[model samples]
Target: MDRLDIIREDETLEDLQINGFSVIQKKEGFRFGMDAVLLANFAKLKKRDEVVDLCSGTGIIPFVIMAKNSISKITGVEIQDEMVEMANRTARYNNVNDKAYFVNGDLKDKDLIKTLGKVDVVTVNPPYKLKDSGLINLDDRNSIARHEICCTLKDVVEAASILLKDKGRFYMVHRPERIADIICEMRSYNIEPKLIKIVHPSIKKRANLILIEGQKNGGKFLKWDTALYVYDENGQYTEDMNRIYYKRDDDNE
Candidate 1:
């Protein structure tokens, strides 16, 4: 069995001490901070709807969604057993274990989709590339999380198409360079790219990431926006980001 490192723990949430679990990353690689928050905050949840978050690392996305909306139920699927276990623990700690379930399984597995049936919405922060598209990490977890070692974008989209209903929604984040391929793939699966927004680091920089919402039976329409400037050449989050990061939920009031 692979051993895990624990850096610290509060009463509820625990941090992954080592950078082993890049998927759920507590400290290092791709922690569920800006990207996750941006997606969750941008999401418009519907009442009495079910959401399935594919590749739901530490269950942070679902947790945030549940906090903001009153949905029917939320389900999380993670390919890694350790990640599933950790997410289950997070559910328990948050007292939402009964409302959500984390299962360890592959999205490409058809049987798993049949058992879970259809969902209203599905979200994913999938692996970026063709595994070796970039330099692979020495650590196994980080490598898989960053690269498409386990499943590719096509796999995620196909699985989501199978898991969603006729008009179900699929939300995802991916590199902007692959825009054409992603649209082609989604359309092939009968999932139309209903809306899309390209995320840029700054007004000066070109788009880096694409955030999209696809519907099972909807047509093509793209909406682009300039979001999140992480640096101003001096390597600090720009002023707009400060407001986004620190601002509380306006709907709360």
Candidate 2:
């Protein structure tokens, strides 16, 4: 067996054959889901771009983007030590250690923010559930990942604002219920909300996810892209969804 196979005993390696990119996720506890994939695909990254992913669980966002884009460097800031270690291992296994890195640090820390300096793009798949609003997950990892246990919505947006260069783009995937909150928080920091896409599970249901982008110090104009439906009537992926899932090369170019 290959070294990856041997090391993957306690984890599951998801292979994206498009660019030979793989992400190693824990067998249990805080595994990435479709949200991370959507955010990666949703984010607009260019070649040799300096990117940062906040609340980057296992570095899925950076790994997925690096697979398709020729990024100069991408750093993932995660609060969880285990996730950071796992992400670094995945980076090495994928032969992208030089271009990708994972650091264990709280995004709310100004010191950590200063060390990162400026970046071309900032992406976040932040905790969607507000603290004290809903039931918290029993698992410690999942609790921190899903709920605003470590950081709140404002904190995530502020971190992104601090990390971005002037006119730098910030992309995030969040629950639809918090769209107003997201827009407000972003605008409060001079990160103008410029683009948005609503994601629906099916045509019959309401949108549950919002993929939004803002430009630091940008003008106040919001463009709403066509809505995305994950499934068609027969419970299969829609054409756009298929393109989203598999259009690794086309979108990157």
Candidate 3:
């Protein structure tokens, strides 16, 4: 199929701004956010490591990792069929299908988990709010992406644990208010929390997001990295933020 044929009427092709990669995003449905970008950056992977991303909306996390890492394979598990189709088309557009793909199946499905087998790394940017906690979006897609209508926090952690190889790494980005719940779930599945970084909108603001990394069947020690401020006091993107977004070159610093 031609490149234009891959996109649908309701979808827009947005530039990822990395290695000439772009993604197909629904104009009104759930789209990639800064949290997903931050989570992808927070993950550390070895060469040839296989990675899986749970709740991979539009496969953004997987694509972001592909831009930065030389991993053997990366799979994105998304429950939404439309998202899976769009993501696969984007993969073909980038000619990265040999190394990256998206699966249209629930992460909590046992059969899907069996098919995936073991992977070296698992990353998730799961729904941060409980189903009943906040005002849910009227759109079913947005609601599922923002609230735990399908998979809860525990479910995400358990799936990651089951899919990970021994000592495999797990990375996630979530709201700071849920830090306690995240730690509890990770530990319950033997995914030890090893590193954490709080993300603040600015220096004066309290942290609203957190980036966490864990290891399966690993140690008990945890280390806190330097806090990340997205913007400077002058309301400009911080140097670190600019680098993460690929807006600045490392050599220039």
Q: Each candidate's lDDT (Cα)?
A: 0.73, 0.89, 0.91
lDDT of 2 by residue, 85-135 (tens): 999988888888988999999999988997998999999999999888777
lDDT of 2 at 166: 98
Give the best candidate by TM-score.
3
Q: Return the TM-score for each candidate structure.
A: 0.81, 0.94, 0.95
lDDT of 3 by residue, 1-253 (tens): 7888888899999888888888889898578899999998899988989999999989999998998888999999999998999999999988899999999999889778879989999999999888998677645898899899999999999999999999999999999999999999999999999999999999899999999999999989999999999988877788899889878644344
The worst-scoring run of ten residues by lDDT in candidate 3 lies at: 244-253
Model 1's alpha-carbon lDDT is 0.73
The ten-residue window of minimal lDDT in model 2 covers: 244-253
Model 1 TM-score relative to the real fold: 0.81
